[model samples]
Target chain A: MTVKLYDLAHSRAGDKGNTLTLSLIPYNADDYELLRVRVTAEAVRHHLRDIVAGEVTRYELPNLPALQFVCQQALTGGVTTSLTMDTHGKSLSYALLEMKIER
Target chain B: MNERIRIGCGAGFSGDRLEPALVLLQQANLDYLVLECLAERTIALAQKRKRQNPPLGYDPLLERRIELLLPDLIARNVRLITNMGAANPLAAAEKICGIARRLNLSITVAAITGDDVFHLLSGDEKALETGQPLTASGPLVSANAYLGADAILPALATKANIIITGRVADPSLFLTPLMHEFGWLPDNADQMGQGTVIGHLLECAGQLTGGYFADPGMDVPGRKNVPDLAHLGHPFADILPDGTATFGKVAGTGGLLTLATAKEQLLYEVMDPSRYLTPDVVADFTQVRLEEVGPNQVRVSGGRGQAAPGTLKVSVGYDAGFVGEGEISYAGSKAVGRAQLAGAIIQERLRDRFPDLRVDYIGSTSVHRTSFGEYPDPYEIRLRVAGKASTASMAALVGEEVEALYTNGPAGGGGARKYVHELVGIVSTLMDRRTITPQLTLFQS
Candidate 1:
């Protein structure tokens, strides 16, 4: 089932050639370890490359535990998969909201 | 002689529909009927009415309603205290008195006014956001802060059966007559608490009873196939002289009153529960309890007391921003996805051209779609954009883009329309004294 995408991370340094530059936001140690065990770096890079059209840089699981993402600007072309809109008409920093499993 | 003085709090402003809210008072059935309708925005409307007409310049609907129901009310001998005097309450009262005289009924109508403080403010610019001299924000649309009910005492003392005012707080409307009848001092903490709780219970008419309750199963009076909802609409309170109080919406309304609905409204817009501040008193909402008194009414009691801080919350709404609405449809094979692409294109276009347009997307759907988890997929999307200034221009720009959607390419040929933008103000004012005796005038027909 489609779920709310939480633990969002935004692009840190603008990477032009890299198809998937990593964006990392501080995360909990437990959650970081959990995602690492479930989701792999290659799977994320491939999924991101289809939308980002950039090379996937190496994944960095920070010691501080953070929301790690293979990043790109929000896609504008082709078919749309899922859309999340804010009521206040402004882009929010991914770091501001916490992601949780919908009960 | 109905020794039991029942006070009903009337919400909203409808000069035309005013009688239904106050009809019970016609027979000395109740001692007081309080009509409340003066939000920061409504005050602005009142000012606009004054500019358009010399006096009694409101919607005129309430006045018309009063004219129709005056005979019955007079025969009933019920007293009324209302804030129906928007821009010119005195003018409104004059009109009511005229109506009374034409019917050969000698009724006393009194008006309480002059709380409009927009002109009295001097020095310090009203800062838009704590800037410059404290007063230099911009031209004030409406500057009437929620004043204490003490101002109405002067008018109530006139022994005029009816009292009218301009922009009184909702709770203060019900509490004013109580204060006058009970001779409760402004500083009387216990009485103040009692009155405050009483005001909350009656403020929403049937709302306290079962109007907005949570249980769908509970058989609410009016909703339960009952008739003459009016006769059943009686909200009562068991208030003590010490300020301890419990109350519920009487009966005769079609709604439910459960712990959920009671708690929801109880927490509605309250900043500090321990000190639920109002113009009348600093009340405590934290310890209040809600119990089902009957099928319809819910008793609210046990509110603690708190010392009020000096600052008064003045709702001041200024031009926050402007919003624009437009629509687009998808008919192609990948209709939904194509519509999404259109939204993206519009956003891209706005960013490229204005670089400042704040746009948001809202999708509307008739059928539920499982693609987005539990929520259904929206067939049509409503796109909105708002900005700090030049909202009209932004709205126009969006309108232009929407019209071009048909000619530029695909994405359905849905039309675009512009909506109006209006904002008011509510600011907090600090006052050293607790009470003020306002000027009262009686107009007799």
Candidate 2:
């Protein structure tokens, strides 16, 4: 079944320079392995291709049942120079959560 | 039972809430109260202020924060630590001492310096991301290294009532006290890593206490989905000698402390779980764990660390020209068309002056920029155009062009606004730790 990533996890976004890092922590601990298998770096890159100008990297944390994705060149010119109202990419987490995941 | 001490966070940033800090000082039996007030670009702005007038480069709210919490801190015997010093720790320390004297309170203040490396560094230093040399990046404003707890330990040894620092790592503000109290050495990576986790969690004050974790109808039980943020309580930690800690908020204060909140904060700004770099030690957050021990309380432990990095990260700020922004709103039937027309009109008007001017339709693609599904023809739209220029006056022209659209192009356009300001460009580089020496100056009242 297709379900939104938000239904399975919660995320928080933070940025440094042009890289936007999103932390995806599963709502249920048991879903960690499933998410680890389904949510690939390529999947995130494909989902955010419109915004991300650089590559996407994902780091796993089985202990926290979470995944951390660093989307490079995601912030137009980052905090100091980005003209976007949401300079820190704080809303990007919601965009990532909107991605469809197979349940 | 292991020996433990309580540490409370007063203010997270330069402009954080002051009343909650006062509450922590008056109510919590805290041994130390750390207020982290410096951000990446804050020191650069402070340096700009200092250039205009020396001794004015500290946190603007420093005096107000001191006035509000001074008496309570003294009464509770809580020593204070902060990077509120910004670009001038000595001046900030002197001001604090002066305030203590006015209140007839005797105290010792220690100011830690030597974070500024602008003069020491060669102009050819390469930026981490762009690989562009510093000399090629216009006039420099400030270059401060992220110093570690080593500098702070000496100030703590002096037994100062308040320790003011410039450009120390955020986590070091909390980690230094734990190391001092527990006699944790510099090479104790595991303990330092554990302490770093606690420091990182508490560094943002209310972030781990449901302030930033709240989302309606979401989040798990024991986690407050709808938080009371009006009187948001700052975070405090009860740390054992072994580096395990329990996080909680002050009693009768608004905010929730839960395992979920702790987990959210754990990964904040963290790039890699296996190698979180800081001046003190490279902490590994992958092994960390958070458990809800009781109501509004969570026990956090299991942070492992590796050897400290030989080089420290430096934030170099340069004059990046000026930015001018202008916005105008259009509503009614053809709002989207009107806004788009207004944006094009401004772009045409400022094409010669600001060839790189950028335009955004607020209701359409202001944030995600066509990333999200297309917005249906909206009832209202805000047209915004912003650009960078060599001088303030040139930047101001971009905004002026947008304001002209109200009368010249778009019908029903209103709420036109414009602004021009200087921009500070930040570039990160690393410096060998051995080159920068941290020194402490003492002031007595």
Candidate 3:
């Protein structure tokens, strides 16, 4: 069955300079391998093309069963200089959650 | 039973609530309390103030925080480690000593300085952004290096009841107490890694407790949500000599401590899970494990590391000129069309002068530009217009233009507001650790 990523996983967003990093974790740790294959860096780059201006790189944490995504040029010009209302891109994680993947 | 050091974090940032910290200090039976009050741009902004008016660059909230916590710290004999010093550690330390005297208490305070390297910059150093010279950012306001736990070692050795610092890494404040209490050598990679992991966990204080966790009650099935955040208490750790620790908060407090929260926090603001670099050590969080031993109790283990990095990261703040903004509220029928028309007018009016002007629809597309699912039009919409310019007067035009919308006939635009303020730009660079020296100045009441 197919379900929204938000139903299968939860995420958090963080920033350093113009780079925005988001952590994606499955609600069930046992769903790690299944979600890992479905949520690819290429898929996220395509998913967030409207917001992300640069490349997206994914790193895996097997122990925590979480995925960390490093998105480039995401904040426009960092916090103090960004023109966006969401300066830190805090809600970008929710945007990622909108993706639909295999359950 | 293994000897354990009890540590708690009071303030995660400069303007955090005093109540949660008070709760931790009074009830947690903590041996040490850390208040991480410095952000990336805080010290840079503070340094700018110090240059304009000497000795006035410390944290504005430092006095109130110290005034409230000093007695408890002295009475409970709980040592304080904080980076509230901002740009001037010595001045901050002196101010704390003054407060202690007025409170009729005898306490030793020390300040860790030398994070400011603005005067030492050659101007030819490359900025981390575009490989351009650091001076390209214009007359820089401040440049302070992110100091490691080693920089704080001398202050801890002074046996001071309170240690104030400027521009130290957030995790270093929590890591120093562990280093001192356990006699963990600076070069002990494994031990330093473990301490750093715990430090990272507890550094944000309330974040570990559900301050930033996702909300509950979504239509999506099966999300175990965070509860009792209204009176949420900060997190504290019971650390063993071998770098093992059990993290928990005060009993009868609001908040949940579970494997889910820990997993989310484990990668919060983290770019790489394995190579988590800090000034203290090259912490590796990949092998780390978390287990909920009991209700509101989680045991965190398996944090490893390598040698510390050779260079220290520096936050350089520069004057980014001024930003002028204006907001107008539109309610009732046809609010959406009116707000969009107002935004278009403002954008058109300033198109020649401020090409980078921005307009946002507050009630609708302000936060997320694209909606995930289906959504209906709202009854109310607030239109916001903002633009940046080199001069304050130039920036103010953005607000004036927006305010003119009322008379200019956007039709029923109410509650108009206008404002203009200066802005700061931040960039980072790296300097050899050997070049920067940390010095501790002592004070007594």
Instruction: Tell me which of candidates 2 and 3 scores higher on DockQ.
Output: 3
Model 1, range B120-168, lDDT digits (tens) per residue?
4553434332435433433455555565677777777776878888766
lDDT of 3 by residue, A52-96 (tens): 889999999989889999999988788878777898888888888
Tens digits of lDDT, candidate 2, B198-224: 999999998888887777765445333
lDDT of 3 by residue, B1-445 (tens): 3389999998998889888888899999999999988888777778888989997899989999999999999999999999999999999999999999999999999999989998878778899986898879776888999999999988888879999999998888988988888889989998888898999999888888877884676775436566678898899999999889999999988887788878877788888777888998899999998999998899999999999999999888888889999999999998999999999888878899998888989988777666644567789999988889999999999889888998994899999999998888888899999999988889998
Task: For each candidate, report its DockQ versus the true two-chain complex.
Answer: 0.02, 0.64, 0.75
The per-prediction CA RMSD against the true structure, in angstroms, equals: 12.9, 1.7, 1.6
Candidate 1 runs further than 4 Å off:
A1-103, B1-3, B12-28, B56-61, B102-104, B123-136, B211-252, B307-324, B328-336, B348-356, B364-376, B385-395, B413-415, B431-437
**Which residue runs of candidate 2 sit more than 4 Å off their true CA positions?**
B217-224
Each candidate's B-chain TM-score, in sequence, is: 0.78, 0.97, 0.97
**What's the CA error at residue A82 for candidate 3, in Å?**
1.0
Better of 1 and 3 by DockQ: 3
- Identify the candidate with maximal lDDT: 2
Task: Count steric clashes of candidate 3.
Answer: 0
Ordering by TM-score: 3, 2, 1
The C-alpha lDDT values of all candidates are: 0.50, 0.88, 0.88
Error of 3 at B404 (Å): 1.1
What 10-residue stretch in candidate 3 chain B is worst by lDDT? B214-223
Model 3 stretches astray by more than 4 angstroms: B220-224
